[model samples]
Each structure stands twice: as C-alpha cells, then as structure tokens.
Target: MNTSHQSFAYTLHDVTCLFRKHFDRRAIRYALTRAQWRALKAIRRREGMSQTELAEFLEMEAIAVGRVIDRLAAAGFVERRADPNDRRCWRLHLTSRAHAVTDDMEVLASELRREALAGVSTADFEAFERVLGKIRSNLSAIESGTEAGAEFTSS
Candidate 1:
C-alpha cells in the first residue's frame, strides 16, 4: 500500500473538522448554535417532518433534537403542528422567519463553499465529488452488512 494513501482517512477527518470549525465561527453572527443551525437546515430540506423523523435524519437523540426544536420554536423559527394521522405526534414546520433566516444562511454557506473551493478546477472538483460519493456508498453498504468486506483480499 502506498504510505500516502494511509493518510486518506486522517486527511478526510481533518478537512471535515476544519470545515465545521470555520462554519461555526462564521455562523456565530446568526445567534444560533451549530446544532440549532443544522436542525434548521434539515427541517428546511424536508418541511413537516415529524420530530422522530428529524432525529433520525439528524443522527441525533430524540431528546436532544427535541431541545433544539424547543429553542428554535422559542426563537420563532419553527412551529409544531399536530399530526392528524398520528394524534400523539407533532409535525414540524419552518416559520416564515425561518425561511428568511435559512435564505441568509444559504448565502453565507455559498460564500464559504466558494472560499473553500478557491483555485480548484471544476473538473478536479467534480472528480473529487465522484470519489467521495463512491466512498459514502461503500461505507453505507459496509455498515448495513450487505457487503461484509467480501471483496477484501491479500495484496
């Protein structure tokens, strides 16, 4: 194995950490914690998702996501509507205020993305994305035990 290839996982982790750190710093002005902003973005993507569904999508505990939703609701960024089909469940919706804030967030995120991709050629970026997508698919398969490392072999 190439020694440089061994560092791929570390490099990926470092890049993700740095991106989140930079976003956290830049997002501070919005007066929302990272979790709050993340939840808001997730909710925006799929409006009227149940809290349980949101928790699963966010990969967060139900209780923790509940608190994030609570804070967002208090801030007038979200509203909970009773689910008619499931009387005990609440369907989440973004308020008009949240739509405005998320629009601003989208602009801020675009600026950050542009800054991160600076000097990268479009073809190179596209290739990078393709590779990452493959990696994600492989990992998901492994996690589900559908692949079970069946392709592994001695070099």
Candidate 2:
C-alpha cells in the first residue's frame, strides 16, 4: 500500500479521537457523560426499541446499557414500558423531560459540528459524507460475508 493509503487509516482514527475529546470537554457543562449522551441519542433514534436492540445498536453490552437506562430513568429522562408482544422484555421510551433535553443537546451538537467544519466548503463536506457512507457500507458487507474479504484469518 502507498503511504497515503496507510495515512488514511491513521487520519480517520485521529479525527475520531479528537472529535470525541472535544465533545467530552463540552458535554461536562450539560452534566452528562459521553456514554449517557450516546445512549440518549441512540434511544432518541429508535424510541420504542428494547434494551437488547439498543445494546446492539450502541455496540455495548446489554448490562452496561441497562445501567445507562437506569441512570436516565432516575433522572426523569427515560422510561420503560412492558412489551405487549414479549412479557420478558421492556420497550424503552424517552420522557417529556428527555425530549427537551434532546433538543438542547441537538443545538449543542450543531454548534460543535459547525465549529469543526468551519473552513470546509459545502461541496467538500458532502463529498466527505459520501465517502464515509461508502466506507461504512463496504465494511458492513465484509462483516456480513457478502464481500470476498469476509474470510479474515489471524496469522
């Protein structure tokens, strides 16, 4: 692989780490941890999803997500309702309180994104997004065994 290709992976990792660091610094003012913010955002995306589904979506352990839900519930930000289709499962829902909080969080996130992309032109930003989407799709295909590179073996 060329040097530029090798640098691409490092650049992506560094960008992600730096973004998280900045977000974490800003998140303290909202009295929420990065994990809590992540959980909240995932829940907001799929309001009626079960804990198992959430754990999968967040790529976290179910127990860890349960703990996050517990904290959110204690803070009046989330609620769990019995699943009508499955007695053993609970459907998670955001409270009215969480809705208001989510709105404020959205504004904060927008500000951070704007600051991060200050010098980028709209065309460049759109192209970057498309490239990211393609990368994700390619990776997903490999993981699902649909792509030829799925058979990864440890040396």
Candidate 3:
C-alpha cells in the first residue's frame, strides 16, 4: 500500500474537501452553510428541541449551535419559542421559510447521494454504510467519555 494513501487523516480531509465542494455547488442557494442545514433539518424533524438538545444531536458545542441558530433566526428561517415546561429554555421551530428550504434540501440531498453513489452496487453500499456506522459509533463513544481513544484503530 502507498504510505501516503494509508493516512487516515489525509483520507478524512479529502472527503471533507469533496463534500464542501459538492455542497457549494449544490446547496449554497439556500444561504445556509452545511452545519446550518443540518441544524434546520434536525429542528424540522424534532419540531421542538431545545438548543442544548440540538447541540447534543449535532455533536457540536452549544455555543457554536447557538450562533447558527442566531443566524437562522435572523434570516427568518427559525423561531425560538419559550418552552412551556421550562420558561428559561427555548424550543426550536422551523419557520415556513425554513420548511420550504427543507423541501429543497431533501431534493438536493437525494440528487447528491445519487451522484455520489453512481455505479456502486447495493451490497457494496450496505457494507460501506456499516463501516461508516462503526466509525461513527467508535468516535462518538470516545467523544462522550465512555471509552478511551485506544478503542479506535487509526486506519
């Protein structure tokens, strides 16, 4: 194997670059960054999540998530309503404008996925997905303090 190609960080960086390139080409029109798009999608699905929950779901720092929400709220894409159960906590809601953007995002995501998986077989795709799941689980476990980094193998 080529030594350079064996670096996991290099592979991860390349994938990130590719994703950013495609996202720019395909999803930049909604005036939301990829992180904002993810937060919006989560808000749409959960409908009344708090900023803390949203940050946990997104695996982002609460402050970072708050900034994204701030931008979205300013853009009229999301609204923060006082939680009935907890007046101090605000629940997130997608605005009608956000719903419209979510619809476009779904289509864009589907198209991007199709393009990304062009020519890949179903079995191969399934295996790839399983590998990705394991990677995510491993990283998440490490991140949440359940396990040490020793549990993960650097590929």
Misplaced by over 4 Å in model 3 are 1-5, 140-155
Q: Please write out the lDDT profile of model 2 over residues 30-142, one tens digit for every residue.
A: 68778889888988999999999999998999999999999999998889999999999999999998888888888878988999999999998998897777778778887
After TM-score superposition, what is the CA distance of residue 100 in candidate 1 from its true location, in Å? Answer: 0.9
Tens digit per residue, CA lDDT, model 1, 1-155: 56666788899999899888888888787899988998999999999999999999989999999999999999999999999998999999999999999999998889989999999999999988977777787899988887734432224
Pull out the clashing pairs in model 1: none
* Pairs with steric clashes in candidate 2: none
Alpha-carbon RMSD, each predicted model: 2.7, 4.8, 3.7
- TM-score of each predicted structure versus truth: 0.92, 0.87, 0.79
* CA error at residue 136 for candidate 3, angstroms: 3.2
Highest TM-score model number: 1
Model 1, which residues run further than 4 Å from truth? Answer: 148-155
Local error of candidate 3 at residue 2 (angstroms): 11
